[model samples]
Target: MRVDGLQDLATITRQLREQRERAEAEEKARREAAARLEAERQLFSRAVGQVHPLTDRNLAELPTTPPEPLPLQHWLDEERVLMESISDDFDVSSLLDTDDQLSFRRPGIGVEITRRLRSGHWSIQRQLDLHGLRVDEAREALGEFIRHAHKLGVRCVRVVHGKGLGSPGKSPVLKGRVQSWLVQKKEVLAFVQARPIDGGAGALLVLLQPARSA
Candidate 1:
């Protein structure tokens, strides 16, 4: 009976030692984890420096989309006005000077200008061909071309009305109308029949007024 009692005491002592060792190991691990956490906090603070959170009042909400654009209504209105300004009914016979080659000069412009234009004195800087376009299309295209050329400070240009060889009964349809249109435009200073080498009777040499300084 004494021997069994001693063996029981030995077992109890061994169990107590194992429990104490386990408790110490757990405490060591907790300390190591706490040290690592403290080191990480110090490193983050050093890297980032100090920061302040933004207040809600300082924030701005960005728009998801942009504003709508403007329509080209004004340009269309100007085009309509331009179309109405020129007319085929305007008589140009009185305005043209009777010479070997027909020519026109705006009133107040010297006759020498028309003579020079007829003689190809000014270099042709631009040209517009109304060969295949209908009457209305030709007028609109001619108006835009003249305006654009004058705006760019072009002094000389050519307008090819195609000599009417292909028209009904072989008559030039756009020639007289084109002359009337040119006379109506204030930008035209003078215009004369092109020389034989420059489309001959099929075209007119036109001189434009110098663009006004802005």
Candidate 2:
């Protein structure tokens, strides 16, 4: 009976020791967690990207997106782009010899535009026909688009209002709308009807004025 009692006492002592050890382990874990929290708070205060994580809103607000790229004009900063230097007297015949044609495959111009677009330096616009948009609607949309283009450092853009011949009416509605819209926007530096090799009657070359960057 004595032996059994001693054994029970030893077992109880071991169980108590385990409970004490567990309590110590929990306290240690809490201390470590507090230290980590302090470090995180310090980082949030110091780092630009590291925002306080208490609110889910901060996570959403943190910029996962890349920065705005440099403008294409910056690359050849040595060279100036003068509108006067490039001729305004563009002949339709010079670009196209036939009714069905495309000649505006100016590699030099295309390369420049592509490079600018690829570099995220400039905005390249490709608009579909204003098939359904009313004059006021088209004007409003074009105005907003041009404003955005200017902000994005877009110098040259292609506005595509498809050749209306394919549509019911012989009159080119979108083409006229684009031309009229361009005329109104002062941000438009200079634009000409696209060369035949390009979109020809269906498109216009838009030159956007740059906006002051923050």
Candidate 3:
């Protein structure tokens, strides 16, 4: 008698054979699609190769066009005119007034800070030496250095302007200039002549105001 629910071996074999046939058909379709795509690529390549190639003469005969001038030229010209109109005079005596040792503090700032700076109370975080630089170069360097130090929240710094022994008459030209520049900067809270161990009269210890949180 036949079983109520179980399939016979012949029925299972037939089902497997049908599944294998379906898989083979799908594989054959995929191969045909790939072959068609390769043929189309070959046709496109041949068409591209038939187009004319350009020679050196064709490239050489092309128009020689200059790039457009920058729009900043107008602004630079205006700046030049403005600079030319300004006077090139200042009170030399005011800039050169440092009595025995270099020192200065802005209004409302205590003299104790300058004393502490001179006595090496603060650790020197950075130093800039203006030994061989020209006046213009020194000024630019000093301004940039101070601004950068202020931005980085640096509190104490040293500036070595040198004794200027090589200058004519052995006068310390940069020393006075540095003192003048430091006083003018808003970031400079106080400055004093360095001690003997810190370059003495040749260098200065500067105290910078802490950068305000933005």
Tens digits of lDDT, candidate 1, 1-214: 2436877989888999999999999999999999999999899888999978767667688888977766689889887676657887899999988887668998898898887787879999999999999999999899989989999999999999999988999998998899999999989998998999999999999999999999
Per-residue lDDT of candidate 2, residues 1-214 (tens digit): 3546777989888999999999999999999999999998888567776555565444455677888997877756434322212222333334321223222222124434423433345444544345567656666567667767777776777776767786566777666556655655667654555666557777766656667788
Q: State the displacement of the C-alpha of residue 96, model 3, in Å, after optimal TM-score superposition.
A: 9.9
Flag regions of model 1 displaced more than 4 Å.
1-80
Q: What TM-score, computed on C-alpha atoms, does each candidate reach?
A: 0.64, 0.39, 0.57
Judge candidate 1 against the unseen true structure and give its global Cα lDDT, from 0 to 1: 0.90
Q: How far is candidate 1 from the true structure (C-alpha RMSD, Å)?
A: 11.2
lDDT tens readout by residue for model 3, 40-125? 98997887777665665444554588777788989997785455332213333453226577478777887787778877899999
Which candidate has the top score in TM-score?
1
Error at 58, model 3, angstroms: 37
Name the TM-score of candidate 1: 0.64
lDDT for 1 in candidate 2 is 30
User: Would you list the C-alpha lDDT of every candidate in the order shown?
Assistant: 0.90, 0.59, 0.81
**Candidates ranked by TM-score:** 1, 3, 2
Error of 1 at 152 (Å): 0.4
